[model samples]
Target chain A: MEFWVNRDCFYKAISDVSRAVSAKTSIPILTGIQIIATEEKLTLVGSNSDIFIESNIPMTINNEKILDIFEPGSVIISAKYLIEIVKKLPNDVHVKMNGRQLVTIKSDDIITTLNGFQADDYPKLPRIDEDASVRLSNTELKELINQTTFAVSKNENKPVLTGVYLSFQEKQLTLAATNSHRLAIRKLFIEAYLDGACIVPGTSLNELSKLMQDESGHIHIYITESYITFKSVNMTLYSRLIEGNYPNVLGLLPKDAKTVITIKTSQLLKGIDRASLFAYEGKNNRINIEIEDGSKMRISSNSSEVGKIEELQNIKEINGQRDLNIAFDGRFLMDALKAIKEEEIQLSFGGSMRPVLIEPIGNPNYLHLISPVRTY
Target chain B: MEFWVNRDCFYKAISDVSRAVSAKTSIPILTGIQIIATEEKLTLVGSNSDIFIESNIPMTINNEKILDIFEPGSVIISAKYLIEIVKKLPNDVHVKMNGRQLVTIKSDDIITTLNGFQADDYPKLPRIDEDASVRLSNTELKELINQTTFAVSKNENKPVLTGVYLSFQEKQLTLAATNSHRLAIRKLFIEAYLDGACIVPGTSLNELSKLMQDESGHIHIYITESYITFKSVNMTLYSRLIEGNYPNVLGLLPKDAKTVITIKTSQLLKGIDRASLFAYEGKNNRINIEIEDGSKMRISSNSSEVGKIEELQNIKEINGQRDLNIAFDGRFLMDALKAIKEEEIQLSFGGSMRPVLIEPIGNPNYLHLISPVRTY
Candidate 1:
């Protein structure tokens, strides 16, 4: 196969697909990326046993030709090597494959050759049917993944909790993730008929989120018993689902709270951050927040080994008696606050030992709950 | 002791000194930075037994008042914790030390307290006589360190090779370093009366280089039998000298070469970069460069498991014979090329296995030599 392709376009597609290629794989051929050129498009695919990503370069985009193909064929070259060569090469790269599968890449006066394997040795992507797919804006999907993925349990003992639990019903999509200590929930509404729940591995969701950044096109999602596929523009991502049931987390959030306070997001975030400097070095990264009067709250953390930090921030509103104190892991609190996209946040607490609910001021679309640490 | 210092200025001073503090140390006091405030200036010092860096913030700079000192005292606080607190605190930070050595730092509504050690527990910096010192521009001193420090041997088995060797006589300063495989040498002429040679640890020179990046003032260097001190307007850096004789590398460089090739610095650098892609994965990272007929050179590298690359770059000038092929480690070539601050470089090769010398086209102050690999 021989072709002259736009260097930037080819480099971008190769990079996107290479994210799925694992450096360590049981199957030798899985470390390589498969490149195929058909009559209309050129496709590059990379996969490990867990996930696969494919990106296509259309022969013509926006009425302008991007690739001039002399012959249509396929080859599988080492992804690690191909990316380095392409990234360093100048623009308007020319690539050709001989009958012996020797791939040559040339730009300016620089030439690189790599021995590639037969395309037949590379694994093919599982066929996904378009009729069983639902369409949603890429922005909505990205938001749902980011809002909950950070809360997934890192412990491998519970396989289902290691993935973001995604549930779809009627026209509403709900995403939730919890690590037993903290939980995040987000919902988006789309006009589609889909009913099912799938647990996508946290790593897959993170990679998908990064790939979909600045991408505003519609994403067509297809789910099967074993795998889920997300297709947008000329890229398709397939991730294997965890074979188990996600924990029921809706019951973990309480409907009633004894005290509630609304405070500036940035001010409270900075307070917790300063407390974390000392708390992080101790056995427990615990920071306590005490409600002082109606318009002020004191956040303090003490480490007998390090030192202590006490910060006071003014509250926008409060609806409860004073003298309420609660403690939480600094990391969990920081993560929840960082994901919020609002200036003011309302935190509701049932008691010193109960789970605290945090949500954006006027938005009901996202909520984060954390079980407070009991400090005696 | 009490003081209200500019947060940004204090933070910058702390960061510079903290670079000398080692987290893993046998002496507990060395892990902390010693802070001393006198009637005129406040000093911050960090030490790891081998090197000590001290920075002073004077009460006035450029005829403008910088600090208002209320009392004079000293205390030692954990360097790692102090840096974190100062960096995150708001502007106009107020610090005070109580009778029990409890240090309080406050900014706005944020308050942080740290238990500090008595200043008497901290080690004192070695005294060096300024009568025998030499003065040079900060830029000149920094350049001398950067140009030769990277070639220092990382292996500590030979303690002297781990430091850059400095020789001074007749108003001339010469710096040299080598890993036994490659060597870099630099020379500078300054107006000073000094005579002696000493070896300063490579790590110390690197940190000193970073600290002096924006300093344009003069640096007075004081050297004793075992220690060297670098003093500037408001900062002093003390480093212990390696207690062994440096290897003599003067005889390793030949006076004549059989072949010479003059080429653009960037073009040749890029050529080797591409060749390094395949060469680095191999056992020796060996890449062969051949001088073609007239003013053209072919740079190539081959890996039996990976592939091969051949790049041809135009040479600006050629001296002596053609068809001379030599092989060297790609990394060494890249490092040598990167250190040359010139548009063009001239490389001289004596033979296939001999040490090849690289120097800038017009500048002779710096030279680098790399031993070629004997490929059978």
Candidate 2:
């Protein structure tokens, strides 16, 4: 294989695909990225056992000759060293491998040669069924992952909880994640529909969210029985589906809230943050929210060792019945608040005994529920 | 004590004083900051046995009322908790501490009460002698610390080597540091002078450099028998002097050169950085520089396990009459280059076995010496 590619373009492709490459893998070759050079494009693939990412660089982009392919071939090179080398190269990189285990990379006067593995040793990519492909704008895809991924269980005792549950029916897709303590659910209307539900690892969704931030194109998702693939113009991500039945969480949603409090999101977030500091130093990181006559709100936390903090803010709007007091894990509350990108939010409390339903003032598609802590 | 201070000013003083405060201390009170409120100013002091930092918030600055003293008193508050509270407070912070050991900090509608300790338990400040004082601009002080500190020996086997040797003689203050492998020396002319030399801890100098970056006033350095104090208008830092006789490093300076090469500092730094990648993977992180025919230079590193990299750049200018090949630690070379902050640098070589002298082309106040690695 012999090819000369633009330094920056090659670096981006390598880095994008390397998001899936982990140095600590059971299989040695899994730590390397496979590089395939063809007459039309160069392909870079990286994978651990759970995630696979591929990025492609064409020979010409926007009428600019970005790649010169003297020969077409393939090699698997160590991702760690190759990335470091390519990131620091000052000019276009020239790569050559002629039926040998050594791949030579030359840029300007700097030449680096790394030991490569045979491409035949790489694992085969999973076959993605093309029959039921769903297309969503990058923004919608990002929102689906960000709003729900944070609520996924960090504990692996129940593997299904460690992944985000995706359900599609009736031209709408719903994403939910819960760690038994709190839950986040978001729904968006889609042009097409899928038949069933699947669970994708929260970590993969996290990586996808960050990568998609810079992606402007729409994403096409295709799923097989065991693997799910998200494809864009130049990038592809495939994640192994968690093999388990997700717990039925729709029943856990509150039917309605008795007391609803609407307040500025920033003000509430800052108040909770200060209160949580003291709560964290003391007992179970619990902050209590008190609503009085559905007119005013107070957020307070008491810590015997450190200090105690109490913040009172005037409510923008209030509705429903008598007073209600509820306590929640401070960190969980902060997570839900940060995930929200709105100015004002509504908190619907269920008499301080049931979970609090949180939603943006205007957007009804996103909802976060936090179970109140029992202080008894 | 009862006082109302500007929230931003209070936070700044708390953070600056908290730099010397470490939670992991044998004496628990040492982990807290002593807050002394008087009609004149509010003083915050933190100590960790080795370093002490004091910052003051005056009653008014530039006709603006920044502090209002209600009752004059003092208390010791935990630095960890106080910093967090002050950082998140919304408006002017009003601090009130009566005869009780509880300190109440109120801002906006948020009230926080933290447990405090008696101010008597806080350590006393070091008394700096008033005999000979040296004053340096913040920029000069920063340069003095930045240029030589990196070469200080991290190994404590030679305790004196862990500090920078400061010698004041002939209206000049010379600083020197060496790890036995490399040495960095810098000299600057001062208006005043001291008779003797002392050793200051490298870590202390590092912290002081970072803190002084934002300080606009001149720094007056006062030295006692066992302490060195750096005092500005609003901030004062006192560090315990390392008690020992510094080794003689002047003899390590290269007397002359047989081959000299002038190159762009950034270009040379990048070449060495790329070469170091392979060198770090090999033995001893050794990089070789070859000056062939005094017209071109080659920087290269070879690792049998990983690969090898060679970068050749044209030398802008060359001096001396002989060809030379020398090897040095790539990290040491990079450190010297990074510290120079110069466009072009001159490297003077003494054959292939002796130390190389590196200095910025236009500046002579700084000099770096690196011992050649024996590649046999």
Candidate 3:
């Protein structure tokens, strides 16, 4: 393979794909990035068992030539060394490969020769059908991922709960995740009516979110037999689908509400944060909270080894007449509070032992449920 | 005991002193920060076995009031908890200590009661004589620390090698550190005529450098029998002196050079950095450099497992007729290159097997000596 490409574009493509590469993979070849140079473009791919990311550099960008291909071929070089070398090289970069799979990377002043594997030895990406795909905005998809993934179970015992459940019907797409102790659900409307459901690892969604953080425009989501791909203009991300049934998260909600309190999101978030600092050091990061109808709320956590903290903040509004007191994992409450994008949120309680529902005061599209810690 | 202080000033003081506190200390009380409120100022102190830092917040700054002390007393609270609480508190903070050592930390909205120990239980900082102290600019003192400390040996086999040696005579205060393979020496003039020498741990110098990163003005260096103190306005750092005879490093250098090369500091630094990236993965991070009279320099490193790198750059000037080829640790070269203040540097080699001297051209204040690796 012999090719020359703009250093900045190549650097960006390599860095973006490098996120999918893991240095500790069991498969040795998987730790390297595959570089393919065709007559029209250069494709850079990095992958592990869980994820594969590909970024393409077109031959020319806006009339300026970014790539000049002398020979159309491919090679796989160690991602760790390739990235470090490419980061330091200056100006336009030229690459050439020898018969022994020794690739020499050169810039204006530095020449780095790296040992690479033959392209034929690399693992090929599975075929994905573009017809069975739904297009959605990057912003809306990012919201869905962020709102629910934190509730995904970290315990490996239940593999399905470690992934986010996506349910699409008609024009509404719903995403839900639960860890038995807490559940988060978000619903959004999309123009694409392709109805489908799949469970994707929460880790994949997080990586996808980061990929789209600087990206705008639309992203096409394609679900195949065993994999799902999020493709954009010049970048594509493929993640393995968890082959198990997701829990019925909607059925886990409490039926009714005994009392509801409305408070500013910042106040509650800050209060819970301070309380959890001391609470998290204890057994379960537990905090006791009490609220009455149209009155100030009290949040407190005590640790025998550490000290105790009591924070008081006024309530914006409250419903129901009965005063209520409950104990919960403050960390769970804080996570839900942070996920909320609104300035104010409402807290709805079923009972001392039942799950509490937290929702933004005006937005009906998102909600979180937390099971109260049972205290004797 | 009770006091009210401005949150920003108090926070800065605590943050500065907290650098000396270690959470993993053997003595439990050492993990806490001692706060002593006097009629005129509030003193915060944190210490580990190696270092102690104290910062004092006066009652007033310029013309504005920063502190109001209702009573004079002292308490020691967990640095971890105290820092977190103080970071989140808003506006001014009010601190009150009860007879039971249960301190109430309060702001307008948040209240935290932390368990504390008697201030007398906290380890006391060793006193250094102020009369036998040298005054130096923060910038110069910081430069001396940065230039010489990197050569200190990380291995604790010889405890003295882990510390930087200081020699004071006449108006010049010389700092030297060597790890057998490499040595860095820096000398500068100070106003105070305190003729004494002491060895301070490289770790302590690094911490001291960070403390002065944003600070300006002069700092006082006090040398007593057992301790060395670097004190500026409102802040004081105390470090235990290492007691041992340093190796005679001057006797290790050769009298004359067989060949010499002059090159841009940045160019040589960058070349070594790129070579070291591939070299570091191998056994000794070894790189071979060759130079003759008025010829371009070539820097190369090869690894059988990885590949090889050859970087060539034009030479500005050269002296001596004989050609020289030498191998040295690239990391050591990079560290000395980074410490150099001049754009042009002179590299003088005595022979292929002798120590190489690197010094900034036209500057007699600092120089680095690196022993060449003898490869068969």
Candidate 4:
């Protein structure tokens, strides 16, 4: 495309889309970013097979001139080279389409010509009806994504398990993810009605979280049978939904347990961290947790090569007299503890070998379950 | 060792010595840190084949009890595990030698017993004649190492090129290193006696620079045929010297040149960096530089796949009217520029195809020479 744009404006736009560019993609054109310069704005698009990111820079932003479109055209350039060139350009750059696929960029003292592919070779973005969409604040969506995405299975053997399941009914939206070893669930209230469940890849949720820099603004999400699009100001991200049915995980959480203890989240996190030194040397990083008189808990781990460590954490509230001692993966417990935002957390144990339930104090909407390891 | 030390004191001492511990050594004892507990002091030693670092934590410092030595004993424990355990310990730790080699460390609520190796298995520290040692300020030594070490050859093909050559005569000390392509020479005045030239590996110099954090006082250095010892307050670092004779590079720098140019170091560095982006696509990151009218300079680079970049820099002075253009590796130039602490630098060019001389504006004690590359 023929256009003259400020160095920083073009740089920002190119970087936002470059996140989706993968050099190892099977499709050659997918590695290139598409640039379409109209009389009013310039749109940059980059896509891999699973996710696509597009950003637009208008000719006028806040009544300030950002670009001058000499001619309306489109071209596709290597995302890697485009970013490096734009960042290293001395001043404002003038970009022009040379031959059929050659793009020339000229700055104050530097002139560079890069090979470009035909814009038509790039894949088309998914289209969905804008009217059938749900709205949620960036803060709420980012929080929900962070709380559950880490627990998603990284293996692609079971496609649905690699994605986070989202279900919305009335004003409540629930997100859950599990990798069989651990499960995380979170719920929040929204203003729109979303009744259907969709499986979104954990990677896409991570990218969306990074793009949501502002917390207060609302993000519009349009969902189709196969794809979902999240649109914000000047940017749109499209992600393909995994095709399959998600497993039911509600039965994994405990409804009643023999012992329940509430302890300060930070205090218990530090204790587990100390014990992890010895646990990390063990076969499975297994650490034992013992609750005594319901109000006292001791964490211990040991290895033959390294030494042993036992830390006693104080519990403020206890429900039953039954004592329970169980061993679980220290990493999973650390992750769950970090996700808890409240001052105190309640841990419910069904048995020595059963899945343990961890949740923020007085909050049942967010629950974390970890399967204990057989240490014996 | 049997001792009771404050958590912070023990942690700091162990961390310093662990830097010298080698996990890939053929000798298994080299992976462990030797701890010798005396009635007055506790010493920690860690070593690889090339370097050894020892730090002492005394029982009393400034009339304050930092370490309490219950008995006199010695043992060697895995450096990796010991560091991790001491770092995570809650408060004061009580360390005791159980049998001959087994050790137990007890903190407030944690008790750990680790298997240890016999202290006799560890190699003894090298002995040097301290009477013939020379003293230099830590700041001066650190500066000299930084100014010349980066130019040392990283390839082990020629072992001597990997070390920095140090020569002392009367009170002047000259340090030089070259990788055949570029050379860095630095000279300083030290109050020392006659000492033959010594070759110290660049890797050892780099590590020594980091270990010499105390810049207030002088450090005593004892150099031998096989090893060099650097002694500070309660720390001693011993490094094996590389065995070989360094090449003579005193005549590589041009004493007289047809053209001389003075430019701001920062501006030239930035120009070269920008031009290198395109040049990097070529076989060797080669960038061209042209000086015009003794006051202006231009830098440019281009690749067929990527574009081209040209930057113009203003110079303060030029001694000759002859215009000279040359091409060189951008990475080498960047490294030399970063080593130069002066604001302005003087460059002397002998011809279009010869090495260029770069030195600080008024300082003749330090010089850097870079060979030019043929662009055609």
lDDT of 3 by residue, B118-165 (tens): 888877788878678888889989999999999999999999999999
**Residue runs of model 3 more than 4 Å from their true location after superposition:** A292-294, B292-294
Interface RMSD of each: 1.0, 1.0, 1.1, 2.5
- Tens-place lDDT per residue, model 3, A160-255, is 999999888888889999998999999988787688899999999999999888888999999987899999999999999999888788888777
Give each prediction's root-mean-square deviation over alpha carbons.
Answer: 1.7, 1.5, 1.4, 2.2
Maximum-lDDT candidate: 2
Candidate 2 residue pairs that clash: none
Q: lDDT values of the candidates?
A: 0.89, 0.90, 0.89, 0.86
Top-DockQ candidate index:
2
Calculate DockQ per candidate and list them: 0.79, 0.83, 0.79, 0.58
lDDT of 3: 0.89
For candidate 2 chain A, which ten residues in a row score worst on lDDT? A289-298
Candidate 4 structure, TM-score to reference: 0.95
- How much is B20 displaced in model 3, in angstroms? 1.1
Give the alpha carbon lDDT tens digit for every residue of B70-105 in model 1.
888999999999999988997778889999989999
TM-score, cand. 3: 0.98
| Cα lDDT tens digits for candidate 2, A169-212 | 99999999999999999999999957788999999999898778
